[model samples]
Target chain A: MMSDKEPLFSAKNRKLLTNPLGSDNPITIQVLGICSALAVTAKLEPAIVMSISVMAVLALANVIVSLLRNTIPSRIRIIVQLVIVAALVILVDQILKAFAYDVSKQLSVFVGLIITNCIIMGRLEAFALGNKPWPAFLDGIGNAAGYGIILVIVAFFRELLGSGTLYGFKVIPQAFYDMGYQNNGLMILPPMALITVGIIIWVQRSRNKSLIES
Target chain B: MNTQSNTYTFLYAAIMVVIVAAVLSFTSLTLKDRQNMNKEIEKKQNILKAVNVTSTPANAVELFDKYIVEAIIVNSEGEVKSNDKAETFKVDLKHENKKDLSKRKLPVFVFNDTKVGKKLIIPVRGKGMWGPIWGFISMESDRKTIYGATFDHKGETPGLGAEISKPEFQKPFTGKQIFDESGVFTSLKLVKGTASNNPHAFDAVSGGTVTSKGLEAMLQDNLSSYEKFLKSSK
Candidate 1:
């Protein structure tokens, strides 16, 4: 139990919020939810929308699961977590369709596919089940931000090089295309997403030598 | 309570399911109207797109009302069944496509714009590489050559098959004739390659062969029924 005297953003709690942004990153270090990374990163806009959706799902799922951690029957914890995540995803998808219709259309089935994203399950089983609601929420935000940052980075390069556009706006000058500059078609394909993630992993591991396995 | 007991697990599962179901159903019920409205607006926008009229979600309804001078539902025999705009617009093409062509309620929208002129817009539905693909194809006043087209897919591969929805693919459909010089219904074809010189076909997306073929078949199947209507209108 968190004591009344304990500050809300205590040092330990801060690490829960910050660690996943770098050294303990979910996508690069843990590599949990790579399916969506490959699926939605073709364009920058969908990637950003997807990142926000996943963050919302993850943070809420973490808090809910954490609040019920003790009362949850250990024998059926996984099922409970799945139910919560699925419910939240459906809610998000409905809300998106009602309000952000265009983005919802761009996302389409992938929002429903969020129920299958492993990071939410992994966080619930690992951190939320063991930690208090506050730390669980922080961890959720941290890991989701980690995933979002990488998605944004990959989408940035993909949209810029593949489509010569960012968020559907033409960023590369027409003069370049007039001068025979061609967008890299390969970068637009799904295979290129894996390669981009691979490069990010390689660069991160090389810089943080401790991340390398013995 | 023994949380680990089988009874406890069963109760927990049952209660969780009840809560989740309630939440989901409530959400769906509350948002159904707004979601349906969005879909209706998107359909109107797509219909307008077939005539090369650009519209945002905010202005789609107004533009649709302004540009669509008539919505006519016709049968396979080229006989008009209804001309009520709302009734024709609400005709669900996905369901209509499933019926025999003779029994289908095929909707035709006459878009009247001072600059773009009056064009006939028809809806087409077919399978894509991943899922259902549908689009609107607008024909010029000649009732032969396509004026504009707009295609959308449920789940085609992002940069490949899904390119059918992009302008680069749809733009080439303009000026493509669905009838031969003899006035026979040929339907438009998505040629596999090198279709620049072909007036009846457009180049298919390079990496989207299956989707291209599916779209081609869709045009053939959907447009053949409208042959009588097109000819009679002309």
Candidate 2:
């Protein structure tokens, strides 16, 4: 369905998917959005929820911006994007408060902070403004998923080591605590999320030599 | 030519404004009912918590209906003045720039629990790590011993200050005295050390020092306003 205007799922489009995964990845390559990456990764549940929320906002914003790309005055394009992003964020915030009040409460300012996430803005400016809606949407989702992958991994380790649980479920037996298994309290802190992401980048780069260059 | 240019700019700006406004209005109208329902459910959930009636979101409304018998709004002096429970609960401490001494109406929800009998749940709002923090503080029929508490914050750091909302942190407040035997307002406290052996003191959240302090300050500030009402009720 995408090839009529240019080439259906062309090599360019294929690069869009793979790029965010490694070479041109927003988190690993550009090192954007490290703030939320660290804050929400202390547990898998919040991390996953945050990732989905970001993805929803990113994908929707990309499509909306792409549709309006033609008429968006150059001088006001950034303002327009901000307005759209803010609207979406507010809508999402209201929905969360209404539906998932607890999680929404837990998320708090981070939901409002979605407007500041560079990845969403980056995709709007770098990819969405120039591409068709489908490609822009795909790029947004792909990058969001990449970000989610990093977050889930970090949260997995953090929750396991910090709280000795998975998604708040106790995993390590009481025997481990009885045997003197000390929960790494540091893993629950924000800085640990950063270190976890950094380590993942290092491992990912080592495994795939090409990603190292980026 | 000048007229043409003026006309075009006017039309363009007008169209843009209308389009944006319409889009926002449509979105708002589309989601308004669901959003309102969600907020109502949330309030019900908080009210339920104050009375120790724990339930998930799906059942909050049902549980609230089954347990909550009365909701009344009391002014700072604790006089029953309004029938609107929700509006009284909407007091925004952040928006109201008045000093802490300013009098305001506080929403008090009366829940009749099968196990715990009648309890008064008061809504309290105050400052926290990032912005406003608020919660429901339920008092037993004596209106002294705290029954259960639930707190939420705007932007406090998760796993740290944000833990204030977690059950592990708030559960400590349960059974703590909000007033002394003389009926003097002792104010249930979030203390530094392990909540002194006093019934009025509650343990501070371990990692969330600032948030814990915030919770303490919030309780003191809001509950003090309702002292007159509390005293009159006694």
Candidate 3:
């Protein structure tokens, strides 16, 4: 093992932060956390809020799991990870209710459902258990950011086409509507979110040849 | 230190549960008041919307006190049970809906405004396809014609059933009548197809058949329960 003298932002540690932002993205590449991606992407505001919420839960859960790695019984590890996740999710949900009531109302049960988000569980089991707390923290942030990027991109197009607005503002001009332009109704539905994510995956694979299998 | 032992696993789980339970309890207890205040503000805000008075979160409580001149609780027999603000505001329709008709504590808010005139507002609750749906419905002094209405849902399908909460759906309900020309209560109807020229009917949401039907039943059932009160007031 490398000495503790290794610089904090060493190349390996940097890769842990950067890899998930692109080639190893949690949403597009690993295909985790697509349920929330589809549910909240109808509006840009909710998508951004959800992304931040997931990121907070994931990073904290990672650090906690890493710290408890040695003492956690191997037989009950999954349950242990679940309890940490569920607790963090409830904390986030309560905070949102007290402070950001409107956004929390919009998110509804999806906030609580974060307990089931596979991305957090996958990281806790695969990465956090074997790594130091700092690297595990970085991995959590990177993966969640990767997921957020795809969510924001999908929300951008959906809100624009479906509602003809960005973040609830009128982006399309009145003149365009006068010329008989109508917002695409299909874009507002859940199926369109799946299709949008599929399109992103296609474009990403085409750009990065190394991602494709023979 | 044997991680694979059954005894260790049980002990680990037991300790983990205690810690998690304590943390969750502390959070819930600390934030309970603020969370409830937020909810109360939202309820007041929605009640204002039903009467066509817009209000922000910061001003909801003040405006509610201003516009809602009297918060009265009434029974099925059209008799006023209590006019206390705390008692009236605390009337939960979900719980009342589960009780017998004669024992239900129905809340009725009297909204007074110089520009909008006086109106009677009532709350309704029902089951949607996915979960519970509820809303406030306002009526003109005649107790028959709807003035303005607002609806909200727990977990309806976002694009389809959840459309009930939108302004467009609630707008059409403004001028509808709950009672016919003869004064017999014939609660509003939600027509599956076009409503045509019917004064007692409106079109249901297109793709949300179950939710639409549920909302229709909610309106009919709740409005009919107030029949005695409507006739007595008139």
Candidate 4:
């Protein structure tokens, strides 16, 4: 619907960029990417790294898909999308392997799993297929950010309570241990991550009634 | 755009495949060196860990070179084979373990420890529940008692089997004897539940019996090759 005379960032495109952050959050609202959310959030560093990797892949994949949208055959669109996403994921995985070896090891196969992350494919199919490159790029970044925000938040609480640390730094004072404060060991487990995500969804839905389904 | 034509579809897929292959291979080829260097550093760190010496990735290479005085590739016959040709660091267990025991090049790293003096570190690998479980066992100069040991797994379940890398799991191996009182090579066993006050058998990780047993089997399998060498040395 954007015209040549309109402002570069119109209200419509701004909504596309901002809606995913809160009201249309991917992890909290759309409930996509819950697998990686529960898997890597035991520690904040890995979770943060995973989020960035996913963001890079998602953003780049969306742009590539959108740019090729015109040429992509109707019969082969899904395969085209998979090929693009896989290539981008491999590139990200290789770069991470070269630059951040430890974090790469911590993230492990999850970086490759970004190819299968429904959020990336969802955005490309729902938004990128129909939108222009710029709008698609913004949508990609917005949705990825929404997913990354939830990952970081979940990791924050998990790392804080499970290991009494944040990003590997001991945040809870040792004196607290002397006062019988025990880090919840259960929080380090996968179930606790699901519970944390559930709590976020609950709180979010409670505040925003529109997100609740009949 | 004749999108549904078979000719166009085949051409498109072929072109796409070629493009993806070229870009992926190019990326992998360029980053291979740095990735390998990181792996080497990690291996050095783990080897150092077996001797109670620790170093970060930044300083692992320097520390490794300073402490590890010799890298010998010994065969099953207890003979130290071609020193320069073998290139001990290049010995990969995943490959060597597949070869016949007699043909395998068993690399041993001699660590010059400050307190324990000279220590021999032998690397071993075996199958865990999920994937490969590997470790370094630091043997005292006598080659009988374990100075220290370190275990690492490829894809073991966290908090359960992955605890093999924890200090508590590795510490109990420090004073355990690899040989019995009569000089019988017993290696070590990861017994379930209570350890029965035996020096050769250690209690396995409670929830990680498979990985613990895998480590025990790896130690036995790899260490058996050193039996002739250990006996000859004495």
Distance (Å) between predicted and true CA of A10, model 4? 3.3
What are the chain B TM-scores of all models? 0.97, 0.80, 0.96, 0.92
| DockQ top scorer | 1
What DockQ, on C-alphas, does every prediction get? 0.88, 0.38, 0.84, 0.68
- Candidates in order, TM-scores: namely 0.95, 0.84, 0.95, 0.92
lDDT of 2 by residue, A1-214 (tens): 6546767577887777777877777888779888778777888998898899999999999999999777666655677788788888988887776566677766776787788888888889988899889889889988998888888888999999999999989999999899998999888878888888888889878888876654
lDDT of each: 0.91, 0.79, 0.91, 0.88
Model 3 clash pairs are none
lDDT string for model 3 (A35-84, tens) is: 88888899999889888889999999999999999999988899899989
For residues B1-234, could you state the per-residue lDDT of candidate 2 as single tens digits? Answer: 232355644654567668777877887888788777777787778778766677887998788767777677676666786766456546555554264454554667778867768888888777777777888898878777888899877677766777787887777787888778888987876767767577888777777777778788888877878788777755
Candidate 2 docking quality: incorrect, acceptable, medium or high: acceptable
CA lDDT, candidate 2, residue B177: 84
Better of 2 and 4 by lDDT: 4
For candidate 3, the per-residue lDDT at B50 reads: 97
The clash number for model 2 is 3
Each candidate structure's count of clashing pairs: 0, 3, 0, 0
* Quality of candidate 4 docking, DockQ: 0.68
Worst 10 residues of 4 chain A by lDDT: A1-10
DockQ ranking from best candidate downward = 1, 3, 4, 2
lDDT of 4 by residue, B104-139 (tens): 998989988577699989998999988998999999
